[model samples]
Target: MNIKGKTILITGGGSGIGLESAKQFLAEGANVIITGRNSAKLEAAKKLLPSLIIIKSDVENEEDAIALLDKVTSLGGIDILYNNAGVGSPALNLGIANDQILKNAVYEMNVNYFGVIRLNNLFINMLKSRKEAAIINTTSILSLVPALEEPTYAPTKTALSFYTRTLRKNLEILKSNVKVFELLPPVVATEMTANRNDKKITPEQLVKALVSGIKKDQFTIRVGDTKLLYVVSRFFPKLAFNLVNPKKIYASLK
Candidate 1:
């Protein structure tokens, strides 16, 4: 897709991958607008990129989704709706039955999966009207192989991964102009993964790869370790599972 001269709206744009995406997209000559639930973080992002149009909105809220759509429409709409907002609950052992396990799963699903659907539904029409438009959904490598430490978080991404594919195929069947792109990223060094000692990629590297993939029309953009995991899981499923949930991670869970 031609990102230059197009307008893009990114969710959770205050920091991490979203912020890096905004910077890269803007540098690529696209008009950028960012949304987040934190007002202070939004302001901080605005300060970092003076040209960014920052809006405070939570992806998990239905009302906020509507308001965000209205606001984006008023700003002349967007050529790309990047559903990048996601959340994960603290690690908990799924083997031990606990009420908190269900709560955490619901929270993760609400933000990581349902929130993407809500925003996509609201903006589908607008995207279809555009000459060239796309929806970018960020699913994770964990979707391919479950992580022992991220029991609840992994399933959310897996659900979203399925949804993204189905949505893309549905759009294709309808011959819709709105394109769907799924981004599968490895563990990135971000606030969300700050506590982890896992090998990580910087947000800059990930977003750079994402932008390159978008330009090349790569619908399923898998970055870094994600690319390897995809291949490994295809053939050596057991090895791929072991790679993600290593002995160390399993021990940590206990």
Candidate 2:
């Protein structure tokens, strides 16, 4: 799809991938609106890219999601709805309190899974009105291969991957012009993992891959080593599991 002249709304656009994606979209001549829970971060993003339209809205809140949709639609209908907001908890063990796990689980599911569904349901028909439009749901490589460091986070992304696949198939069955794209990125150099020393792709690299993928109509856009993860998971499931699970290292030390 030609990204130029399209109106795009990206969630969690205050930082990392979202922020970089928004910047690139603006460069591509698209109108971009970014939403996030933190007003300060959103303000900072706006300062960096004065063309950006920032809305402080938490995806975890139904009210905020609804208000965001209305506000963006009023500005101009959205051609791309990029569901990119997500959260992660520290690696957990079964010994953690059940109540605490449950609490974190609920919040993660609400933001990562249910929130994407809600926005898509709210804006799908509006998207159809445009000549060409897309809904980009940000899942992760973890959705394909479980990551030991993010047990809770991985499951939520996996659920989102499932939902995005179904949504794409359903849209095709309806012969709709609305396209659904799933973005699966491996660990990237972002604020979320600033202290981590692992090899990671830059946000600029991700945005470049994403834009090229979209232009060519690649529905499942896997960035960086995520493509490797998909391959390993398909043919070497056990090896893939061991690679991502740090617990395997402990077992090796013994």
* Highest TM-score model number: 1
**Poorest 10 consecutive residues by lDDT, candidate 2:** 245-254
Per residue, candidate 2 scores C-alpha lDDT tens digits across 130-210 of 899999999998998877667688999999999999999999999999998999988899988786667889999989999
Judged by whole-model lDDT over C-alpha atoms, candidate 2 comes out at 0.89
lDDT of 1 at 95: 85
lDDT of 2 at 1: 86
Residue pairs in candidate 2 whose N, alpha carbon or C atoms collide under 3 angstroms: none
Error of 2 at 110 (Å): 0.7
Model 1 lDDT tens row, 41-138: 99999999999999999999999999999999999999999999999888899888799999999899999999999999999999999999999999
Each model's lDDT: 0.95, 0.89
Model 1 residue runs over 4 Å out of place are none
Q: What is the lDDT of candidate 1?
A: 0.95
